[model samples]
Target: MVEKEGFAALVLRLRAEGISDLDLLTAVEQTPRSLFVPPQFAEQAYSSRSIPIECGAFIEGADLAVRLLANLHVKPGQRVLEIGTGSGFIAAVLGRISERVMSIDRYKMLIGAAQRRLDSLALRNVVLRQADGSNGLTGEGTFDRILATAAFPSMPRFLAEQLVSGGVLLAPLMTGEETCTMVRLTKTGSRFDREDLFEVPYLPLVPKVASFL
Candidate 1:
């Protein structure tokens, strides 16, 4: 299992790899990955890999998650919405940066488990819910930033309505016949400016709250 020394090494490695946002890295460092990883995967908590959690969902590769968050550029005091709240690790880290984070998952069991993880960490700003998480968060009001862990066959243009004008949405979207890539959509006056960030491994967004755990 990775210990304190491994975490320090990870920060140093992230720096060495040109992830220049020290504040973001600090937040990542402060948020222990082990707390969110399932017991069987505890030893992989600090590795640069995706850790499986409850409900057959996964936390993306640690470095990949950081890259996406870096592109999202979540600022302090901003309201963030996270779709597919897998292990709740990203939301917890975002909670440290943003004023509040509303994370939703299709799997009810994932939400309950993730909420417990957030509570244990004393991260009260993050709220987890079992919802479709496709486009209906408007009830909670628009967010400054939105990020999705699941992939969509196309850019979820409908989400623009759920974003504050000028808000940014980060997601993994299908680019070709069978490939998925991470992209950022910036709201721009009734339109969106799309930026394809990089390729990422992600599952399709599944609608409906799972009835069974």
Candidate 2:
């Protein structure tokens, strides 16, 4: 009962802050942030703050996910491809609203942990995989929405190609030598129209799977 009230409070706060999407708010309210948070960071799970997870990675603040997903404009019956699955929090959110969610991460440890969380919630639409996040899941076919949790210097062509026509890709890119800012790209024919969202620091999308992790 307390948990329900806590999430309700969060949803109201986010709505007051202009995150008015009902689906997004409901997903946030229904999904237990604790499921994706480490036991040590459980207290911070529902806050708009990033918290450390396993494999030396940190899940982004819930506020960031709200902003990113708001711009991603995910909808029912859409397929989402998520790069850098991390704790699979975003992937789980995508799964709640989208038809299918294919999330990949370089660290097997992270994927394994995320799988457990998703399974606990019975989020069967979300498929967590341990693979090179930067590889773009070449043969996995196309997606209606593509979201990369990791940042890159620029939108990689390989990842962009996986999007179907009129699809949207949300990712953070290096705006300057060392400055990273997230952007939204909408695929139109052979080109994409870019829209700068906000600046947020993110780990670079590195190539190859972590055989050691």
Candidate 3:
């Protein structure tokens, strides 16, 4: 069973850890982490640690998700794109703040599960799809913000083109065989300014066809 006080404490701890965005904090509080995790691990859902979900994916801990959201600086009425939709937790949080969120995952099972979770929460602003995130959403035009929950060998070229000028793109850039660093790229004119934020581990970004076998 999950304790309400424990969950509230975790949120408070995240605030102490520099999550100053009120909206993001509220989203974290509103969305129960247990709902997004495997039922077997529901008791540990609010423990401020990553939990494994379906399709060999891990839902980022609440603190990490809040930190990423803070860096993205999502705003109301802004279009956002998320590369990985694991458990749809982050997408649901973004939907609370952004005008609309388009999330893509290569795994069909994960997409279906995430979509159901978001729908249960009545988060109508998010659209979930199963597609290769590396290529981004073609023919969908540009987005005000783009985020990748997976790590790539390096910054993807296609994502840069899909971002609107002055938009922010946050993703984990692999720095070593088993290590990665979070990078923030701000699109400026035809160029993007890169800033290395911090180190974090994430599943490698890959392009895979959705399978329903």
Candidate 4:
């Protein structure tokens, strides 16, 4: 199994690669990726590559999340929403940067397992639920930030409507040749500006009411 110090070394590399946020770097360092993956691959936890976990899920690449969060102007007391909880690694990372975070996944089992991991880590600010992440969170008129780990063919209109007037939404928008094009949508009055940050490959967003994408 990878040692905690080994993961720290990886985070340090990520930092040198242009991720300068200390809070984010620390979150990625402190959150144990090994705990969320299957026991067999626990040794590869912090290797910077995706590994399969239970329920046919794959842990998200830390670099992808690092690229997304790098553009987010998230504050410590901000309320954030994370879609596609996956192995809950990103959610754990988000927990360190926000006061309250709600992460949704289409798989119930993933949520259950993630909850146990979060509980074990004593991460109390994140709430996990089984729901369609593409549709965005309901009843929340505004959010300080919205992050999606899943790739969407097009930016969901619901997500656009949910962001606060000046908030930002980070997700992978599918573009040609690339599996996903990392884009940031910044809400401005009634319009949003899309900024392409990088390219990535992620599991497709699960449709409403159906899990297992």
Candidate 5:
């Protein structure tokens, strides 16, 4: 297992890598990645890499989580929505920066496991649910910011509609050739402005109904 000092050093390395957002760095420090992973993988939790959680799901790399959080531009008291709650690490980080966070995953096992971790951390502002993330949570109404950890072939219109005007949505869009690229969409009035952020590798965004039990 990594000691506290080692975890702090990892955060410092992330800072040197251009993640200048102080809030994100602080969140990373506050939420030790080791606590969110399985006991066997605790040693590699603080490493700058992704870890498989369960049912083919993964806990995203700490650096990538910071990049997504930075791009979302989340503010205190803002309501944010996260599509994948693997290990609930990113959702907890979002909770640290925002007033409320609703994170949904298709797998019940993952949601249950993540909920325990979040509860142990006393993150009351984050709500975890087991549902089809691709459909988004329209019943929860519009969100100030939305982030999808999984990659999709195309933007889900339902998710776009759930964004409040002037809201920002970040997700990885996959090309026909199976390459993934990060995309940022800002909802403006009835239309949206899209910007391609960068290329990244992410798991496919699968719906609950589409998943094999």
Candidate 6:
């Protein structure tokens, strides 16, 4: 269980890093990381760093995850798509702000575990699916915001198209000479402008199949 003091410490730490949104802080406080991580690592759930979970996968750095989510500016009743659901912790956070959330993961086991946990918490607004996230939640319609937890060599153009005008797409991209850079891509007329935030290490985004030219 995450006690108040521990949660407060986390908020303070994130505030030090320039995240001062009280709503974001409350979302972090309300979401239980213990429910996301494996049973053995529950004690370390509220810490700011990542921890190894089952199948050699790791939970995200709490601060980094929070920062990524901050970029979403999630509003009540907005539809959001999350790539690389991981332990579903971020999904849970988004659930607090959005009317509906669709999160995808390639690994079946991770989705299964996350589903059970989300059910236990009565988080019905979010859907977890086992699929290729790079596909950008096809048939789900355009989204108000799209967030990718995984870093890839390049941002998928489909994801860019999926974002509604005035919406934001946040992901970590591998730019030249940089292993990972968090990018904020906002759609304009015919092109999108990219703004880099900070360095991060995230799992690679799943590749998409293409038709032969």
| lDDT, each prediction | 0.83, 0.85, 0.86, 0.81, 0.84, 0.81
- Candidates 4 and 5 compared by lDDT, better number: 5
Model 4 CA lDDT for position 49: 76
Q: Judge candidate 1 at residue 55 and give its lDDT.
A: 70
Candidate 4 Cα errors over 4 Å, as ranges: 211-213
Give candidate 1 misplaced runs (Cα > 4 Å).
209-213
TM-score of each: 0.92, 0.94, 0.94, 0.91, 0.92, 0.91
Positional deviation of 160 in candidate 3, in angstroms? 1.3
Q: Clash totals for all models, in order?
A: 0, 0, 0, 0, 0, 0
Per-residue C-alpha lDDT of model 4 across residues 68-185, encoded as one tens digit per residue = 6778878899999998888888888889888989999888888989999999999999999888776889986678899887888987778878898999998888776457877899
Which lDDT tens digits does candidate 5 get at residues 1-213? 374865676768767877678877788778878888888988877776888889888787766777788889998989999998888999998999899999988888888998998888899999998888878886898999999978988887778888889999998898757789889999999899999998777878867652544
Clashes of 3: 0
Q: Write the per-residue lDDT of candidate 2 for residues 1-213, one digit (tens) a residue.
A: 545765766677677778889888888767788788888777677677788888778998877778888999999999999989999889888899999999988888889999988988899999987887776887889999999988887777788889999999988897886778988889999989988988887877677655556
Residue 5 C-alpha lDDT in model 4: 61
Error of 5 at 27 (Å): 1.7
Model 3: per-residue Cα lDDT at residue 116? 89
Worst-scoring 10-residue span by lDDT in model 1: 204-213
Better of 4 and 5 by TM-score: 5
Judged by whole-model lDDT over C-alpha atoms, candidate 1 comes out at 0.83
| Residue pairs in candidate 1 whose N, alpha carbon or C atoms collide under 3 angstroms | none
Across 1-213, the per-residue lDDT of candidate 3 in tens digits comes to 364765677778876877767777777778888899899988777776888887778987767877899999988999999998989989998998999999999888999999989989999989998888778889788999999988999788789889989999998999999999999999999989999998886977766555331
lDDT of 1 by residue, 84-106 (tens): 88888899999999999998888
Per lDDT, the best of the predicted structures is 3
Clashing pairs in 5: none
Clashing residue pairs for model 6: none
Q: How does residue 31 of candidate 5 score in lDDT? A: 84
